[model samples]
Target chain A: MSRHLLALRQATIGDASESIAAVLDQLAREDPVGAQWLRSLDWAELRRLAAERALAQAAKTLACPLQKQYANASQYGTESGDPPKGTCIGVLVGGDTGYGSSVQLGVAIDGQALSFFWNVASQEAASGTLERMRETVRQAFREQTRILMLELLSEDGEVQREQDAAGRTVLRATLVVGGGAR
Target chain B: MTTKGTITIIAIPKSAEVEVHIDLPEVPECTRIAARMQAVLACLGAPLEDIQDLPAPRQRQGVSHAMRKRVRGGT
Candidate 1:
């Protein structure tokens, strides 16, 4: 997998309100810690924060899975055949809450498979937890693959609950792959 | 808006590569910047599959606070 960082600066001169809000939104998404603190402040304080420094909301995309897999295919009998059955993609969504003080992390998939995993943490300064975030991402991928419609080998469908709220636990649903149209 | 201070970094595992994206100026542009990163990923063989628009999160105010306000009758 290859990773790259793309950053752009956006500054709105005349009406600082719109520009400030936009920057705060991006910051909340990128830096949850900083966002948490920002959330507690009133508009005046928020504007002050905006005026102090330009917001930098950075996000990363994990890619290039196939190219990396082609080499190890010999071991898995993945040679010269059906051209990689599926695509395994992963992403990490994070940001500051509009309040500009709290940070939130959400991880989900593309299809009907909607899995939003989030955690609210303090703004120990505007930043993301790299290691923790990566681990969750890997888990998401694993969950997606196991639940793939066709990958079921036995009657082993399980719903794992990571957290519970109001007597309801957040479910990590798996995709069932591999039945060839059944 | 400028992205000077913030640095966007992508870490590729297999080839052990790291791509850096820097935003110039003071403020950062979110959408356009995201698009540029998508372009870089497209080149690195990670084209976006499809964009799924999820519902926005709704803010939840405390019910107890609302109840208290109702009882006080605009105190």
Candidate 2:
């Protein structure tokens, strides 16, 4: 399993309005310790805390389950000097498929089976065609995970295709989030 | 709007392997995120062979909380 960090830099989450208060009250009812930890923060910090639960869901969905032990003791500031807040999560990036090591995590689309990517050389495909394919995959993936990635769609993002020596391909997405520190 | 950060998500053959940024910009709706995650899992074809409600966690000896929320991890 590989580890990835979801870093946040002074993103504004707004004031502790009544709605947010209600949410915190509910959180307290469920997890008082967490609520206490969250309540101490201003809206900016609260917004950062919100990522905690969301990330847990994300990690769980990826089969690379989120472990609290991996959480950094983010009590210090960093080079960016903005608290350097981040959550380290274990990611299952590669695995053995018997024939050899494969990054094909065995996922399907629209409940349809996918052909082995190694058999189809991405280099042979036309540049535009490959880009289209990659876009199609990205769209399908976004459509499938719209809920978890709700806010990310609005941000300009890019997708790249990565292939190892074994021709194993991994589609990587980099989504930039606009700061909402209102 | 200023760019605050970037989330790197990897998508594998499993259409659902895509990593979510979960960068809390404004709203951090836990229920919404959980619902979406559950949907993503279903989309990934996680076998749903069984449907049993999780048992309530046992209360700690002297703790005053019951932790009634059914969330898998209160992270």
Candidate 3:
């Protein structure tokens, strides 16, 4: 019998302003062309851009077979007939505490989902947290997941404010084995 | 019969609160998967021992019986 796996990846931003700024700084250094547009964006625009970028990065890591321009949900695997029995991986970000933000990421094999989270209160902390989450994604791919789905969400607060707020972000995943009934 | 499993990992970066859950069918096929998960957690520097175990689901019949007895002997 063939085995199947699925994994989910996610992240949560407690203070969008700080998180956006941090992401923008990184982008400015990494992608000069994109940085130009990012540099001119206001706080509100930057927040939107950052969220989109995060989801895109997650999708890329999953190697989603069907690529879509929208940020939020994406599916990978087979389209027709019985999907091959294999593994799946997912990443998520969530848990936004007032002091900082928390990010969660992981993979699911068969019906099992394994996830990890990181909380950062300061920009410095966020930098490290992002790197670790990225590394976790790399590791999940090495483990071999056939299908991946990524979801992202942000809480409501002062959009332009720089202060951190209390909130929570959850990253969840589900898997099915043997390509059985879903 | 089909076997299934689930695992969840939660981490708090500030206070460093981390929680992991693993749910699998009570069968041998899951052994290798579990071991691989443990290895992944190790590579991530997450302690395997710290993962909290989820309580087994209560029997539906037992719950119903308890509810019936409680209703008959209303407090």
Candidate 4:
């Protein structure tokens, strides 16, 4: 069975507001045609253009079938219980700040099945825990376990917990793969 | 008056994959922008299946807090 993990690094814009302004300015100075095009857009038109760019960027980054499979599996739901064994790939993205900062991870083993987890937390703790989650994925890649499990861990090596709430860190780890082993 | 805010788009990749988050000025503007974004996603070959509006950080905290309480209360 083949298992793969594709990690898309966070974009390096420090502040979205500032970055957008700067990018627009740069476009205007360096590419007058593009700047003029942008300037001609209504507010709604500009937003549509932005959305198109973001989608195109993500699509380019996830060109591989495995990555696409994993992404599909992560977002959709499947029947309850373990997935039939075969080749399974999981894709997860997590971070403390920005849009969709809540911890969301999805694994797709078979073609149509998906298992997902969402955890909401304070910004400070969410950021730290997301780093640990990435490490966990790396470890899973190294170990090649048939079943993968991960816990949100703090910097000090203890299981992480939401600061303002009473609950242990939640990590629901299960992989589903349909069809015969590959 | 023109309303101003940010919008984030997350692509979900099934038949098509895109999620949108809007913080625009007015409801009408938000609706118009969202429809336009959907069109863009379609042109990009990944139409949107779901769209979500992300709340501001402070509002998110409140929602999360409430959710945690509900979970704890076993509702």
Candidate 5:
């Protein structure tokens, strides 16, 4: 499985523009018809994921508050979107992930699809799709020797975009083991 | 260290094996994921040529925790 983790090493958290665009794209899909490409994502020759709770479910999600209008996060608030036609795909019992230092992961969702403002107060789970279409080559490199792993846990958490001790728009979640998408 | 490109496979449990480090061009994350998955499938005894041609996965994203039937397709 380390090789699988190695595969995650090359992936970064995605730039703020990509993150914001993804948020918009997902939310727009929830809107009435003809509002698909509110944010343009190249679905061609791309590798993507759709999970039982995307948007913010796998790995931590990022939003540049300085670029809020571009973020299109107003519609969904801070908690973020979920898989349409959903179900409870995961139930994490707040515990510790035992891994050594120096392994990092940055996760995001990008595809020709959408996420929505889910009325999940009563729904126990969410649905999603994960797609891996092809491979690509760009220009980048890092001087490191080791391994990294990425684990996509959940996205649709109940968020309170308040300030931490340092006063940044930090996200904190209290996840339920076998409960609704709260 | 050899000058020629090489591929190595190690025996493991039910999981995939580690591959030789192919110092290729910049690739990973947004791309190469499909290629990595292809490698994994290949480790499982699937043909390489066929794995290379798999279409984008439209498979429904269903959770495997606390559920009965597999959930497919979402709103």
Candidate 6:
């Protein structure tokens, strides 16, 4: 149970971007057809799609924040004739759990296989546990996304997207949790 | 002395000993989040994992007190 409280002032933009992209790719492969379908939807429309699907609960959990305080104090006094005094100091701080979709991707629904992927991802994004989280990761194809989708595919094709059986499209959302407490 | 790490465990009564690691950077906050995560895990009756707090400075008590007050008020 390792933990870190980092006030990272834009120190890990690359990591965040990479993670965001990785998550998108994961969602895309997990449900290819659904990802294709979601790719066809507009970004705003996809955001609205999540909104329509009880987004508040997911939003709350993913937006966890935290704060802490540290203090080191000492006392100084003398018994002999002299003025008496004491010293005290403290540090106060605040930060977030770094969990939320910083960036979003549009997903398109192409077939049933893709549909299951989207449904699962959306469920996980909104209310997913470690088990679901693990399954989602397992289902996503990371390397293929970078080499197959980014290097080869056109800009219009690559997006943070996923789809479901009902032709329902959803965009992949980025969720950031602070690292260091590993 | 150079920065060092710490381990703080907050356990539930009649339950297993839950251990959390508090990296030197965010010891207290790691402690706080670990505590919250522990509660969340317990409520769900789920197995726990070592949750890491992002690297940063220690949290300030004054702000934390204010935030706690706000949380209490909100609830």
Model 6 agreement with the true structure over B1-75: per-residue lDDT tens digits: 222323222222222222232333433443443343332222211223333332334454322210110010000
What do the candidate models score in CA lDDT, each in turn?
0.27, 0.31, 0.31, 0.29, 0.21, 0.25
Model 2's CAPRI class?
A: incorrect
**Candidate 4 chain A, which ten residues in sequence have the lowest lDDT sum?**
A145-154
Question: Which digits, one per residue and each the tens of the lDDT, describe model 5 over residues A1-182?
Answer: 12111111122211222343444344444431212322232321122222222322322222201111111122323232222222222211111123221122122233422211112111111211111100000000000000100111112323333444543322222222122311
DockQ for every prediction shown: 0.02, 0.11, 0.04, 0.02, 0.01, 0.01
Q: Model 1 misses residue A78 by how many Å? A: 46
TM-score of chain B of 3: 0.39
lDDT of 4 by residue, A1-182 (tens): 22222222232100122223344455455444434443443433322233323323333343312122223223223322222332223334444355343343333222211122323234524246545553343222211110110110011223221222332222222111112200
**lDDT (Cα, tens digit) per residue for candidate 4, span B1-75:** 322344432222221222234444344444444443333222222223343334433233212110000100000
Across residues A1-182, which tens digit of lDDT does each residue of candidate 6 receive?
22222111111000111222233344455444333433453433322222222122222333422111121111111122111111111111112224232112112122111111111112223343423322222222121221122112222333344444544332322111245211
The candidate with the higher DockQ, 1 or 5, is 1
Writing each residue's lDDT as its tens digit, candidate 2 over A47-111 gives 32333333344434444433333222233211231222332212112222332212211111111
> In terms of TM-score, how similar is model 6 to the real structure?
0.15
lDDT string, candidate 1, A1-182, tens digits? 22211111111111222233444465567654434443443533222222111111112232212111112123222232111222112223343443321222332222212222232333412355533444434333322222221112112444343433333223332222123311
Give the CAPRI rating of model 3.
Answer: incorrect
Off by over 4 Å in 3: A1-167, A176-182, B27-32, B43-75
lDDT of 3 at A173: 38
Off by over 4 Å in 2: A1-154, B1-6, B9-75
Better of 2 and 6 by TM-score: 2
DockQ top scorer: 2
Better of 1 and 2 by lDDT: 2
